[model samples]
Target chain A: MITLDHCHKYFHKGSVNEVYALNDICLQIREGDFITVIGSNGAGKSTLLNCIAGSFFPDSGTITINNHDVTKWPEYKRARFIARVFQDPLLGTCPSATIEQNLALAIKRGKRRGLGKGVKNSERDIFREKLGHLHLGLEERLLDRVGLLSGGQRQALTMLMATMIKPEVLLLDEHIAALDPKTANQILGLTSDIVGEQHLTTMMITHNMKHAIAFGNRLIMLHQGRIILDVDGTEKSKLTVDDLLQRFYTVQGEELSMDSMLLT
Target chain B: MTLYAALGAVEQGLVYGIMVIGVYLTFRILDFPDLTVDGSLPLGAAISAVAITGGINPYLSLVLAMGGGFCAGVATAVLNTKFKILHLLASILTMIALYSINIRIMGGPNIALLGTPTVFDAVSVLGVPPYLAGVVVFALFAILVAVIIIWFLSTELGQAILATGDNPQMITSLGVNTHTIIILGVGLSNALVALSGALVAQNQGAADVGMGIGTIIAGLASVIIGETVFGTASIARAFFAALLGSILYRLAIALALGVEFGHFSFNPSDLNLITALLVVSALIMPNIKKRLMQR
Candidate 1:
């Protein structure tokens, strides 16, 4: 379980550039819940994910994960239970590392890494099996550097890495936004497969309205650092891109702009 | 260059190979512009020289010198990671501070080891000529260090260090404490550098504070030249390239020192000029080759 209470985060506090990145936020993430988060630019979607990932501490709040108060925890400390996939493909994996080496690192996530061989002989078959599922011919190229792969392949690999250790919380921040439409759909399929197989508790931030509506069991929309619309189960299953836009228009009235809403 | 001069250059190259490997770890692998090596090199020389002068075993003094260099590296790492200082500025600060610390350790600007027993003397009982013995010992040390470093980099701990340099955020997200990795990586690099410095002091039969000035530049030049000439296809290859690069660099310097143009022979004072030219050529050679290939 992940919980955020009275979360208030301000950037450049007291300065002319001061803006509330997160405002009096209150949220509860149930176990095994796959939540899709949607928001416009500066809508606090990334900030919420960053806070939960322990990238930075919330200015004022209580963030608890699995009943442990992790508000004061550093990113590496929280990484034991949390995994993140960034929007930029380059941000997700080390380009200089080999494919097998990258997988080895992910396998050791939330565990102690010592002086052992990084890509153990025993893990080779497992890595090969996992990469085979991607159908990108990466299974045969385990020794190839991650930099040699295309951006879409990197994102797919990143998704696999995020769930390698069955993380307690998997945060995907616009992970597929950088890929082509076909690649994006393929990665989305892989994401669904991994999340299902592992039963992962996930929070995915996406700009595409269709993906936000299609993927997760629950949906939340953020507007100016506050959750404006939240729906789940039957209500979320019935939601359409137009309905979501209309909801936003009702909330912000004249401030709602189509440019901020990305359509597929 | 004479045959004897060429042999001497190879020996010096082997000793400095260790230092170039150290530079490669920080400048290339860790992506850190560390000037700490400038001071740590002399600090190692001072520590080894003082210990040897005090009747300690020369080999034991090398270990002590390495320890001193490790501590100096940790100081720089702390200044950058903990204090949130820019890495370049932090290393520069450590380098400047080490200048005073090195002098205090040596009790003077220089220490001559004339008539003092050294590691070379200890190894001379093999009945080999002095020049050949120096070459054999330094070569073995260089190869051993290269092998060990290559093996370590293939390990989990070493991969974490590479990842920390490649992308700190990604490594940190994978639950690796990047600050700790940075500290250990930089520390390990400086330790090797110091070991090289200790050997240098023994080879020269003296240690001087100014011996480390521009040491980082020399190391960088060797590394760049190695990558440009030999290529860095793999970690092991890169290691060998660094060693080979150092030897080639020394040979180039030795040959350049003897060059004459229109009755103006190159002076020993032109060492820096030679190094600068070598580095520039190395940097531009690949692009030149590519252009030539297009034609």
Candidate 2:
């Protein structure tokens, strides 16, 4: 579970160009709760995820994870409890390293680094078995350079990597936004399956309202750096993208016609 | 034409190969085109030679050499990462800075501890013959450093640094603190390069500030040659290729020197030209193979 209380984040604070990215946000997420966040460009959805992932420190707030006060923990120290996937496929892995090497790194994230053999023989079989979940034939290519992979393959591999160790919380920042539509669906399906299998508490920021409505037990809408709409369980399932868009307009007092989110 | 001469080539190549590995870390692994290698090489030699001359322990001298190079690498990284200076430009600034630092470390334009205890002194103490000592030192350092590199980059923090080079956003997203990783990578890289310089100074009996000139080119030549020769597959192979490329490059240089044995009484000054030609040949070899394969 994660909680953000009275969170405030400002970019370029005290400067003429300063903009508030997040304002007075309060949210509590329960264990195994899959929350999909929908927002337009600059809706501050990504900003909220960043704060939880410890990429940004909230200007004013307390963040608690699993009953621990983690508002002040630096990123590396906090990595043991969190896992994330980026939108850019290339951003997820070292392109020049072997698959096993990459997996070894993901397997060891947030641990003390030292000199020694990187991958043990036992870990190799473990990696192969895990690679089976992706269905990408990557198991046999454990020694191949990750650079040779297609974007979809890499994203799938990254998603698997992010959830490999099952951190306390999983943050997805428009992870499938860069993939082609077909690959996007496949990855989305994989995400649902993996989250269900592990019962991971997940927060996925999405521009696609359909995906926001279609996946997860809960949906939240953000506008102007504030969460304005929250729906869950039966109510979430009953709502369509049209209904969600209509609600955004009704609650925010503005037309929900952001082309970027709608087009997505 | 004989085994002795070939072994000599291997020794010389192996010594410079350490620089190649350092280059590999920055240029290949970290995905930064750092030209600071040119200056760090001599900076290592200068620090080691000066310390050895000042009666420092040989082991400590190597550490100081590594430290010197670490400083240079840090300067480059700080400039690049913090100041928003471009990578190439940042390296240039560090390289320039190191020139003066090396001079300051030496307390002169150059210094030689030709008869001092160096990285090679341990080998001689072990009763190895002087001529063979170079190769022994090279092999020992190569294995030790290679082991350290392979292990260091595999750890969770190390792996995150690797990920930093691959994708900074992921590292940031993962809370890896990319600025710290950048500094660490540079520090680790140039430390190896400086160690190479210390060994070189000990082998040759002195260090000159000018010794670092063209060092980056030589390291790149070795790396490209290694990639062409071994076809990079893993971290282990990338390292082995660096060593192999160094030996092969040395042999080519030796060949060039040998070719003019009698036709011209070539002096040591010819080394620069010979090195340049060998680099050109190595650069062309892979393209030639690719072209032939197409045919």
Candidate 3:
């Protein structure tokens, strides 16, 4: 349940190298909607997510999360209602911390943290139960440093961490792009299971077009800081990459470039 | 080593090793280069000495001395966290301020703490031998501090402080207020240093305003030697390594004073030189070790 109206974002505003990151964009997300975002580099896929995550303030827009204005909130303050998993696995976790400590921090995401004896036996049990579902054996290695983990395991752990308290919205900024294909697929499967289990409203940005088509009920193609096509339900199910290419041509009125779009 | 030499060196090492623990907390644990130790060490000594001369119990005076160092740390933390001063600048400001503050606290250049009811006085209160006081005091406090620190590092806030050093951004995203953690870590670290300073002043029977001139370097030397000797992969081993390193460093210095009488005078001035040489040796120890390993 999030909405953005007439959002505008500029980089280095009033300077020579000024660029428009988001321009007059409008988007709405329903509760439990899994939206896939696909675009070329500099297409504002990340800026859009950044805008939603309170990383950047829109120059002109009203953002409402579950009907409360959050446009002016700071990143730390917005973190109360939102959880994000970065593209890099390392970005989502403290490498030197044990799995249980990191999970404990995530569990108390919006609260004051202090020197309490951390992760009681019951909390450890809960984290292990959640980690067990990932099937990566992180649950068994709860005392191990997260730095020792493989990228895939870390990503899965981050996913588990992000939804530990089930924030109002989940932002996945190409959460699996850096992993090898098999690990990426595994993380994606974990993502689906997590989203389904938590009923989280999610926006996932990906460079891979097949994942864009296959993962979500709703798909939006962003080109030049604007949504070019918004398809969903059966229309999205029937759509192939070829059909998506033709639609991008019709919508943006430009031949599809960026080889990544066709190769995948 | 002779009995006198071993006892003297080990006692001094144990006292200064507490300073090393303080340095480890900020430089290694909190990742803050708090220069406040340069002033806080002498500040603790001065405060404890003055308090002891003022008819206060030496054990209580030592605690007050630690509190003085904690204040210095808190002031630095506040400047950096609340006033937005850069870390190095904040510590410089506090270190500079403490110089004036210590002069005012002692009301003079120095004070003596002998026969002043120090923590070691209790052993003699029970009619223990005079030579055993330093050993008794050192063992009790060093062991106590080590256990507390190990327990604290296992805590939630302590882990967050560790995480803050590794990546503040990740912790902040998880809603950790890193500034608070830094303040707590620095306060705790310098408190340990000041406690060491208090004991050193009492053991030496006097506190001079300049006793802390190379305190940070000495602490760094101990920590570096510890890490090089025992490795830094695990937390518990690192603490034990630091303890062993401090003892080793003191023994080496004692040996140098004993055998190198022709090369250099074993005076107070030589301490700075010795510390500088120890640091250089420590810096080169790792590379030398790696080269030796390759063979």
Which candidate number has the best DockQ? Answer: 1
Cα lDDT tens digits for candidate 1, A1-264: 999999999999999999999998999999898999998899999999999999999999899998999999999999998999999999998898999999998898867878899899999999999999999999999999999999999999998888888888999999988889999899999999999888899999999999899988999999999998889999999999999999877777645455466441
Which structure is stronger by lDDT: 1 or 2?
1
Model 1, residue B99: distance off in Å is: 1.1
Worst 10 residues of 3 chain A by lDDT: A251-260
What does candidate 1's lDDT look like per residue over B1-295, in tens digits? 8999999999989999999999999998999888899999988999999999999998899999999999999999999999999999999999999999998999989998888888887568878788788898899889999999999998889988888999899999999888998999899899998999899998898888988888888998999989988999988998899889999999999999977888898888889988999999999999999999999
DockQ of each: 0.78, 0.35, 0.53
- lDDT for each residue of candidate 2 in A49-108, tens digit (9 for 90 to 100): 888877779999999998889999877668888999889888888787778878877776
Worst 10 residues of 2 chain B by lDDT: B259-268
Off by over 4 Å in 2: A6-24, A57-74, A135-141, A180-182, A248-264, B1-9, B57-60, B78-85, B114-131, B154-158, B171-175, B254-292
> Which of candidates 1 and 3 is the stronger one according to DockQ?
1
Better of 1 and 3 by TM-score: 1
At residue B147, what lDDT does model 3 achieve? 75
| C-alpha lDDT of candidate 2 relative to the true structure | 0.84
Q: Sort the candidates on lDDT, descending order.
A: 1, 3, 2
Model 1: share of real contacts kept: 0.77
Models ranked on TM-score: 1, 3, 2
B-chain TM-scores per prediction? 0.98, 0.92, 0.93
Expressed as tens digits, the lDDT of each residue in A1-264 for candidate 3 is: 799999999999999989898988999998888999998888899999989988779999899997889999867777888899999999888787789988987888877656687666779889989898988778889889999999988888889889998888899999998999999999999899889988888999998888899888999988878888888899999889998777767755544444547777
